[model samples]
Target: MLALEELAAKYIQKTERVLTLLKSVNVSVSPDEKKVYAVVDEAKRYLEDAKYYYEKKKFETSLVSVAYCEGLLDSLRMLGYVEFTW
Candidate 1:
């Protein structure tokens, strides 16, 4: 059985992977509106929140954070920052 510490570490690693995937998206900067920039900001914030909740042992909240993280990724893809893979 995986220890709590190990499980936490794994969760954190998964969170980090999500962060990296978010960063890999390339967004174009437009003069009038900055869509990608906003999405990235939201994603970073959500990912941080996920980490916070995970550290606090709030699994449900962390899961919600992960949802937000995926939402942001979807938004990024919709905005053309990333190619649609799923």
Candidate 2:
């Protein structure tokens, strides 16, 4: 039972590690809605893949996951989902 709990805890912690986005990264986005829409699709796919890797307990792959989120966030900013604070 203790072992199971420990493993579960480790699993949760590892999954959470991939939750962060690299800070202060900036990219330009076009004001065009069509271009923003395309970016939204691409970014969503990447972030989803990243989450998939993170769930597999692959830390290296998790880093790639957050990279996807960062990409998506940039796209969202361009799409007007959020402002480009940077």
Candidate 3:
């Protein structure tokens, strides 16, 4: 098992990478499409949660939050709801 500090550091790096991906992606949400907007918004929230948990030394929760963010982003990409450069 990894030490708590090591695990937390790894999670912080992951969260940073996910945030970078989000920054790199170009996602446009239509003002009229509430459903798609909600989905993207939820993903953004998860990203924020990941950072928050990572700062608090909750590596497991941070990893889970980043995973959820990635899932939402992938679904949006698959549905053609958002456009981004991979």
Name the lDDT of candidate 2: 0.52
User: Each model's C-alpha lDDT?
Assistant: 0.67, 0.52, 0.69
> How high is each candidate's TM-score?
0.63, 0.47, 0.64
Worst lDDT 10-window in candidate 2: 18-27
Clashing pairs in 1: none
Q: What tens-digit string does per-residue lDDT give for candidate 1 at 1-86? A: 97554555565567567667544556344333466667777877887887788788886777677667768777767766765443
Q: Candidate 2: where are CA atoms >4 Å away? A: 1-31, 75-81, 84-86
Clashing pairs in 2: none
Ranking by TM-score: 3, 1, 2
**Predicted candidate 2 versus true structure: per-residue lDDT over 1-86, tens digit per residue:** 44533444444344334324323223344456565556655655666665566567665665665565566665565545445443
Of 1 and 2, the candidate ahead on lDDT is 1
Alpha carbon deviation, residue 86, candidate 2 (Å): 10
List clash counts for every candidate, in order.
0, 0, 0
lDDT of 3 by residue, 49-75 (tens): 877887887878877887787788778
Best by lDDT: 3
Better of 1 and 2 by TM-score: 1
lDDT of 2 at 58: 61
